[model samples]
Target: MNSTLLLKKLYKRNLQPVLTDLKFAIALLLIIALFSITGTVIEQGETLDFYEANYPLHPALFGFLSYKVILAIGLNHVYSTWWFLSILVLFGTSLIACTFSRQLPMLKVARRWSHYTRAKSFEKLPLSTALEGRSLDQLAPVLAQKGYRLFQTDDKLYARKGLVGRIGPIIVHASMILILLGAIGGALTGFVAQEMIPSGQTFAITNITEAGIWARPWLPKDWLVRVNRFWIDYTPGGTIDQFYSDLSVLDKDGNEVDRKTIHVNEPLRYKGVTLYQANWDVAAIRFQVNQSPIIQLPMTKLQDVNNKAKAWGTWLPTKPDLSAGVTLITPDLQGTFLIYGTDGQLMDTIRVGGSSEINGVTVKLKDVIGSTGLQIKADPGVPIVYAGFGLLMLGVVMSYVSYSQIWALQVGDRLYVGGKTNRAQVGFEAELLEIIDRMAGSTPSLSAV
Candidate 1:
């Protein structure tokens, strides 16, 4: 008995703090949600270099106020934040507590039949009514035809229906709980990997945020993904028409397990993982160079050993002609270059890593590469979220649709009838008095009925 009392005291002590924490969590969740909406109205994930180039005059301020920092702070990835997740947990707990502590008990009480005085009290309600009847038994069957359960005691009658009425709020609250759970499951159990896989290439996800692995103890280990082909089609008017990818999932031994064609709206799912059409970008071109042997200079005894040795660096057209030779006058220094002749004479100057030409020699670049970016994800909480949606819809529909009833109390020859509804109390009251007039075969007054 003492332990039970102690437990109750402990629960009471924790209740206020838990409620306060829940309030804070709700406020923070609202702030985050508002920030997400505002961020959508703005832009996100722009580079410092882009901002500096675009707003050159106010580079410092522009860079400082840009969304890049927010992205770094994981606002672009807000649904995956630690605090956001914590809020989900707290919200779920509070929802559970509120449902169990308040809603459940009220629902239990609503499930049972109540006194006819309850119906009589509703006559003063805004949506209540009164009727003159010689016998309630005659009207009870009429109300039953209209889908109400009639209860009679002595001279008072009570009628009610839609016992599931109380489930509406419960279902609504359950949906919220399920939504939070689904979000948490998506954040934790779900894996998000982005890859710019070129057409006709297969690759494995080897990197994640904070150098995490693709396969955790709770996830699949041998899941492999491959992009067999990618296509981009344009409309006759030169607008984007369609974007798609031919993809496959592979087994541990490199055997194909599944294959499908995925488009912007359509995605490929294997096991629990899904590949989405996130975006696309251009890949780097391949560049190669042939080096010519040069004599190495030895450091002198008196030379400073800490200093880096400098050399001349240059490039020339790979041709059999003596028309041009690019010279690196000081490769070890800043990007300084000098064009030269076979006779070892200077022709023109250019910066290293910068494009330049000399004499009749011509340079060529080739092998432009491109790729499509895909967002790979796996989530286990989607069913819960969808279930929650179903429940919320049912709750909302039921909450708006309600049941109404009217009752009459007869003692000897005097008849007194009252009306009530689960909703629209004021309108129901006026309609009830109007109905009372029709039953009495005379107009009604507040003092004379």
Candidate 2:
């Protein structure tokens, strides 16, 4: 018995700090929010050179945040860091402690009733009224219609509504815990890889940019992805409208398993892996020289795509004299190129399936081959995350309900009624007046007819 008492005391002591001091939970929330912002601000899983070039040391970011600091603190990948996850775990622990130590017991207390055997007990309620020689039968149906549950005995009665409101906070806490578990599960098992494949090329997932420590077992090892075709649709004003890539999943024996035509926001999924069409590039241009064999020339972008206009250009030797060549430039994958002559003169604008004479030869533009940039991801916790979000929304709506209760007692020739509510003060008062009116307004006694 002494040992049991000691263990109980220790448990109570440990529980008091976590339950009484809410500051720790609040602080954890603020830190998580601040670091989530940092995750968005600082790019994740970038190369050392990328960080060095973008966040250089010569003029470090924000005066003190340098590449060295970011690397050392793991700011480059904050979401998966040990410290951030530890904070989430601590916050969840506090929630569990708070739920069991306070909320559950409070709910149990809320569900119980202390019958007012003495008249003084009825007098203490926030709303109470008395009528001599009356029965409150009419009050039962009215309260029941307002969602108040009814409990009764011979000379005493109790009714309450919106008990569900008491369960909302518990559900909210549980939902948050589920969300944290989902995030942790995803971090432990998710992997993200990138592949830029030209049309007609097949590749396996190898360029992993972001992944959890335990994600290797889940990575694709038996499957191959092929970009069967890629094309871009342009607006009338010569801007991109949309780009599409037709992808096919293949087995080890090269048999096709699945296929999809995907663009932005639309992704293809197979065997827990998802492929998103994130970017597109001009890979090569196909040209035909007037009944001669077709030649495909590789294209390269002229400048950084972000800083300058999107354009890819290639050179073609049109004259056997070896002194003259044509530079073909296209602003987009519109299959239209600005043909520049060897003398640096604007020769002509050529479109796919159109022919132009230059250097005593007819140059026909055939097609422009585009490449698709695919972001491949495998996350096993997506369903759990979705379920958590659903529960969170449900808990929020349920929390709005009011847990109102009414109690009544009878003595000699007097009926005394009283009520209380956990929320909506004005509404509860209105309910009191309404109940009093119903009891007084009834033609017969307030008991069952």
Candidate 3:
């Protein structure tokens, strides 16, 4: 019995105070905001080589943040870091503590009606007045008409309205806790993968760029994604307007289960996995050189010079000795190619199925194969987060309602009336005056003192 009492005292005095302290909660929120900003400003889930080149030691970012520092502190993966997750957990605990220790008790107090027996008790109220020759029977109907729930005795009466206002803070706390739980769940069970698949190629989910420790179960295993075709839309100015990929979801038997043509801002979702079109590239070039069998050569993206646009290039040998060849370059998938001879001169420009004479051999361009880049992700907590936001909005609306209460007592023909409200003081005063006028107008013997 003594040990249980000691534990209760410790909980009430030490653990409860620290967990429910508003200042501590605010500090944790500020820390979380700061870390979120840091995560956004510094790229997350980048390779060590990327950080080494971008955040070098000789010219360190902000004079202190080097690749070594980033790696040591786990800044590259801020949301999943142990310390960050601990902060989230602590903040969530604080919200729970606040809800139980403060909001629930306040709600209980609001639910109970207080009966004032003496006239002196009403004197301390924010709005108080005494009515002469008034009875509880006359005031009950007035309070009822004003949308108040009444609790009455023989001489004392209490009335209250808008009790839901007191519950708003509790709902807000619960919503915030739910949002934190969803965030933590996503951080623990989500994964992001990137794929660059050529047209007509089928592949499974691999090459995960970022993932939580327990994200393997969320990854798709029974299905594969196949890129049927990839094409681009160009504007009149010869710039890319949009790109699309016709993708199909295939089961283990290679039977198509779902298909969609996805572009930027349009994604394909299947079985909790979302695929977004992120990038595109030229994969290979198909051509024929005079009586030679059709050949397909892989194209390489060339380095941009002087802020020039992106282009892909490939070389095709025309002679048996491989001494003479021609370079083919294209800036887009518009079926146009620029042919350059071995003498470093522009030989001609040709479209698909068009021929050009280079090194005394007729070259015909057949097709330019394009590859689609897809960013795939699986997050299991989005619905919970959305629900939390909806509840938060509802709580905010409910909190605006005014929770008002009034008390009355009769002592020898003298009636004491007093009321107070948590919000809208002016409106509450007007409402009280209106109720008094109604009581005076209804009962000819009642008059305000």
Candidate 4:
């Protein structure tokens, strides 16, 4: 008796109720969805300066949201936060627990057999009937036509259709578990970083924006990325039509391993790492002074309110006193520069490989070098997450199939029939009527016994 009471207590508290409670599952789903929405509406993983500039305290966003509040709550990196991860883990636990306790047990009940021995049992069913002179042989043929698996013992028989429906809940729970596992794996092992590499230069991954604590940073160790060239195409109105970056992957010994020219939305994947062309900027200018050695002049942003466009410029002196000089200005990396005279007038326009006289000094525009911004990422759980979603779709479709079941007993020429179903009650009722009509036809006599 003590063991029986203890077992009942365990079943109620630990084994059965916690796992099979629909309200508990619903609560977990709601919590997960709420947090997911929060994660989406807020930006993630930005610099301190960016947050400060965007989310100021004086006139805070929505009257209360500021950078200080965001940083304190770790909203900048929601996906990698401990609380968000804990929610995922708890939701996964609920799915796994529900799978074993509720779904599997329901499936077992669907598969198990129970022969109705008494006609009163048939009366207890949602739909039941008793008739004279109909046997199991008359009912089996009709049930078989409807695709039910049969089980029989002496005068009793059980039949069911759509056993696949019983597996649907299990599949749904299992797929959810897989999805949660994949998300956790990605959060633990993936990394995101960005780099800005100038044209004709090679780079390795060093600027990490956000990475999992357990992420392996030394990935693709033997490979390096080279930005061979960066250029942009312009429309007739001088608007940017497109930009491109020609990239190549090299090995440790400096052999070309892979190559591709990537644009916005196009990317290159090498050895589990993906590089996307995300941005572009002017790096420096190559200039020469009257056939002398090449002088690389680093360009600085022109903060002059005189020109209301994004432009870079550098000033080169022609006189020893630095009083008379020319300012070379470029709006883009299109190999074109606008030379401004000391009196702020356009002196001459120079193209790459072209020369012009500025303050009696022959000045040439060698090259306008540009930099390419690449966003790099490595994720290992994407495939598993995709598979989990596939299974989720399949399971939802299968769950709609309606698992209908029936039982019959022919005891000494008196027929008994009963039926039950989880879904599609109208369909199950129609099937029952057809079977009843067939049995009444085969026996040639019928009565409610």
Compare the candidates by TM-score and give the number of the best one.
3
- Worst window of 10 by summed lDDT in candidate 2: 440-449
Ranked by lDDT, top first: 3, 2, 4, 1
Q: Which pairs of residues have clashing backbones in candidate 2?
A: 135-446, 136-446, 137-446
| Residue range 83-105, candidate 3, lDDT tens digits | 99899999999999899889999
The whole-model C-alpha lDDT of candidate 4 against the native structure comes to 0.83
Candidate 3 vs candidate 4: the TM-score winner is 3
Residue 24, model 3: lDDT of 97
The clash tally of candidate 4 reads: 0
Better of 1 and 2 by TM-score: 2
Clash numbers, per candidate: 9, 3, 0, 0
- Residue 368 accuracy (lDDT) in model 2: 88
User: In the order shown, what is each candidate's alpha-carbon RMSD?
Assistant: 10.3, 4.5, 2.8, 3.9
For residues 1-449, write the lDDT of model 4, one tens digit per residue.
Answer: 99999998897788667656789879888988887887788777779988887889989999999999989988898888898888888778778777876779888888888888887788767777777778898889889988988998879999988889999878888898889888888888888898988899998887888888778753567888989999888998888888899999999999899999999888998877889988888889887878678888778777556445688898876665877788889988777899998889998899999999887788877888888888898876677899899999999999988888898988787888888888887778777887778765642312222
Give the top-scoring candidate (lDDT). Answer: 3
The candidate 1 region of ten consecutive residues with least summed lDDT is: 294-303
